[model samples]
Target: MIKELLEAKETDSFDELCVRLGNFLGIGKAVPPKVLLRAIDDPPFADNLIVCRNTPGFLQSLFDDPKTAQYDGDAGKKKEDGKSNTELIAKAATAFLKWGKAGFSTVDEATLERRENACLACPNLSEPKNKLQKLVAVKLDKERVGRRTGDKTCKICGCNVARKIKLPGESCPDSHPAIEGMTRWNEPQRVAAAVAE
Candidate 1:
C-alpha cells in the first residue's frame, strides 16, 4: 500500500503524500514529517522495500527548495558518538522546561485551539507501529504528561502535541519551512512580561 502510494505520482507534495499515508493508516490526516522520514529510515520499509529505494530523494523533490536535504534522508542513522533519540528528546525537554521556568506560559486559547487542530490533523500525532518502546515508555513522560504513548506525540520532539501546542513558545519542527508553521510561538524570553503579546 505504501509503495503504491509513493509510486502513484498523484501525491505531488509532501503534505499530499502525508495525507495519503495518513488515510492508509486510518489516521484521516497528514502525518508529521519525522514520522514520514522514519518510514524511509527504517530497515524493512526503506532498506528492503523496492518502492522506497529512492524515497529520500523523492521526498526531497517534494519541497520547492528544501532548507536541508538531511531532513528528507534517513532518520535512524546514528549521530556522532551514537547518542540515542531518548537522550536527544531529554535534552530538548530540558531546554523547553528551562524556557518555561523563565516565565513563559501557554499560548492564548485561540492559538492553542488552532495548533491543537493542526496536530489532530497530523498522522504523526498517533503512535507508530514501530515506535521506540523504551524511549516512549520513559523519556517522553514529560511531553506525554496528560496523554498516553498511543495517543498524540510529535514525531520530531516526541512531545505530546496536546501539551506542546498549548505552550506559548511551541512550534512544529518539520524540516520543510512552509509546513513548519502549523503553530506559532513567542521568542525566548527571561521575563513573563516579554512573552506572547
Candidate 2:
C-alpha cells in the first residue's frame, strides 16, 4: 500500500495524493485534505504512513487522534517508558557531544547496517509522540544511512534509530536483550568495556 502511494507521488498531484491517501485510509471525510497532504510531505508523518500500512488501523488512528497514535498501534506490545521532554533534550545533547568528539564522521556501510539491524530488532523503537519530536525525527530521518521500513525513533535515547545508527560516535543506550553485555551499536572499546564489566 505504501509502495503504491510512493509510486503515486510520481504521477499524482498534491491534491490527488491527499485524496488518495484519505480514501485509502478510509477517513476521507474525517481528515482535511491539507492535513493529509502535509502527512505525505512531512518526514515524521510520512514515516508513520509507512508504518500504518504495515500495521492495520494505525493510519486511521494517526489521522483521527495523533495524541494517542503512539500507543494505539502497540496496545498489547511491551514498550519501554518514554522519556520526558527534559530527558529527551539531555540525551540529544549528549549524543551531539559524542558525535562532535568523533568529528561527525559516519560509519562505513557494513557498520551502519549492523547498527540498523540491531535497532530493527529492538523493542524500544517507536513512533514520534509529539510535533516537536516529529520535527527532530525529521531532521534525523534526512541523515539516515539505511532506508529500512522499520526505521523509527529510539525510545531509550530519544534519537531516530535510522540516523543514529550511522554516526560513528553514538552508542546504544541499553545492552542487547539476548547478547548479555553487548550494547547494540557500541564502539569496539565500549563493547569490550561492557563485556569486562
Candidate 3:
C-alpha cells in the first residue's frame, strides 16, 4: 500500500487521483489505509489498488532489538555530511524531551551526546516514562497535541496513525543543526505508534 502510494506520487495525475480517491472514498484522515480503501471502494483506482505484506520477521530483529532500530540508516552520510538520520526526531524529541542535557552548541556535540544518550537509555523514545522530562514536565494547556505529519487514518480501526519523528528535524536549543540520513516517519509510523495506544 505504501509502495503503491509512493508510485501514485510519481503519476502525472496523482492530484486527480487523490481527488478521485477522495471523492469516491474520502479525503484526509489520521491514517492512509482508509483513504486508500475509499479510493478502492469508489471509482478509478480501487480495483487497481495493490497490497504488499510486510514479510514475517522482515523486521523481527528490530523488534527483538530496538538498539538496532535506533541505529542510523546512514552513518557514513553523517560522518561526511556531519549529520545522521533522526536529526529532526532528535530536535522534536529534544524539544519534547529536553530536561537537563547540556553541550548542544555544536552539531557534532549534540549528535554525539544524543546518540550516546539514546544508546545508553535504549528506551522506547515514545514511552511516557522515557519521554523528555521537558515535554512531560511542562504544563501544556493543550490536551491532545495536533502535529502535522503527512499520513492517513486507518480503515480497519478508523484510528489516526503516525510514525516516529525523524532525528534530522531536531534542533539543539543552542544549535539547530540537521541530523544526517535520518528520515522522519512520513505517517505510517506515527499511525502505528498511535494505534499502540
Candidate 4:
C-alpha cells in the first residue's frame, strides 16, 4: 500500500494524493482534505501506518473515527505511547550508552526473568512485520540475549523484547495495561535516584 502511494505521489496532484490516501486509509471523508494531505508528507504518520497495517481495521479506527482523529495520525502525530518517535530514539540511545559504560553487563537472572515475563504478557509486544521493525530486531539479535519462545518487539520503544529485558539501564515505557499503578518494568534504580536528586 505504501509502495503504491509513493508511486502515485510522483504523478498525482496534492488533491489527488489526498483522495488516494483517504481511500487507502478507508477514512472516506471523515478526515479533512488538509489533514489527509499533511499525512502524505508526514514521515512518522507513514511509519505508523506501515507498522500498523497488519492490525485489522486499525487504520480506519485511527483515520475514520471522529473521536480519535484529533489525537491519532490526523494531526501527523500519534501519541499512542505518550512519547514521540524522536524521544523513543533518544531513550534507546541513552540506554545503549549506559550499557556500554557499564561494560556491557546485563541484569541479574531474576531481573531478566521478571522483565521478560512482563513483556511476554504485554499487548505492545508485537512481531516485526515491517522492514523497519525487522531491521531493528535483526540488529538487536546479535546481542545473543537469552530469548523466550514468544519474544518479540516492543512497539512503544521499538526494541526487541528478548534483548531489551537484559539491559540494566532499560525500563518499560508505560504502565502495565491490566496492573494499575504498576509499570511493566519499574524504572531502574539508577535513573530513579538521579531524578530524585
Tens-digit lDDT track for model 1 on 18-78?
5544443434466455544444333122211222223444333332223223444343334
Put the candidates in lDDT order, highest first. Answer: 4, 2, 1, 3
Q: After TM-score superposition, what is the CA distance of residue 197 in candidate 3 from its true location, in Å?
A: 32
Local lDDT at 134 for model 4 = 47
**lDDT string, candidate 3, 1-197, tens digits:** 23223223222232343343232222232213233223222211121121101322322221223322232234323332453224422322222112112111123444434433332222222222321111212222233222221232222222221211112222211111234433221111233333222
TM-score of 4: 0.40
Error of 2 at 28 (Å): 45
TM-score of each: 0.31, 0.41, 0.17, 0.40
Full ranking by TM-score: 2, 4, 1, 3
| lDDT for each candidate structure | 0.40, 0.49, 0.25, 0.50
TM match of model 3 to true structure = 0.17
Q: How many residue pairs collide in each prediction?
A: 2, 0, 36, 0
lDDT score, residue 195, model 4?
23
Model 4 lDDT, residue 40, Cα: 35
List where candidate 4 sits over 4 angstroms from the true fold: 1-99, 136-145, 149-151, 177-181, 186-197
Candidate 2 lDDT tens digits, 102-170: 333578999887887777777888986654345434333434547562337888766666656665656
What is candidate 3's local distance difference test score? 0.25
Query: Candidate 2: deviation at residue 98, Å?
Result: 4.5
Please state the error at residue 43 of candidate 2 in Å: 22
